[model samples]
Target: MLSGFFRLEYQNRTVLGEWKKVHWLKWKVSIGLSTIN
Candidate 1:
């Protein structure tokens, strides 16, 4: 039971990391576009 809980937490952390990366990329793209315009 403890192992299962740990695994679930790990999965959530990885997913959150990916989500942050996506948002970071989108932010950079928007900044670039704004500078160009």
Candidate 2:
């Protein structure tokens, strides 16, 4: 039972990490475009 809980927590962390990375990349791209214009 403890192992299952740990696995769920790890999965959530990875999912959140990926979500943040995607948002960060999008923000960088938007900034670059604004600067270019």
Candidate 3:
């Protein structure tokens, strides 16, 4: 039971990490475009 809980937590963290990475990339791209224009 404890192992399953830990596995779930790990999965959540990875999903969150990927989400943050995608958002960060999009944010940077928008900033770059604004600066260019």
Candidate 4:
């Protein structure tokens, strides 16, 4: 049971990390576009 809980936690972290990465990429793109304009 403890192992399962840990696994779920790990999965959540992985998903959160991916989400943050996507947002960060989008943020960088917006900044680049603003500078160009």
TM-score of each: 0.97, 0.96, 0.98, 0.97
Task: Assess the local accuracy of residue 25 in candidate 4 as a C-alpha lDDT between 0 and 100.
Answer: 100
C-alpha lDDT of all candidate models, in order: 1.00, 1.00, 1.00, 1.00
Q: What would the TM-score be for candidate 3 when compared with the true structure?
A: 0.98
Q: Write candidate 1's Cα lDDT for 1-37 as tens digits.
A: 9999999999999999999999999999999999999
Candidate 2's residue-wise lDDT over 1-37, tens digit each? 9999999999999999999999999999999999999
Predictions: Cα RMSD each:
0.3, 0.4, 0.2, 0.3
Better of 2 and 4 by TM-score: 4
> Where does model 1 exceed 4 Å of error?
none
lDDT of 3: 1.00
lDDT of 4 by residue, 1-37 (tens): 9999999999999999999999999999999999999
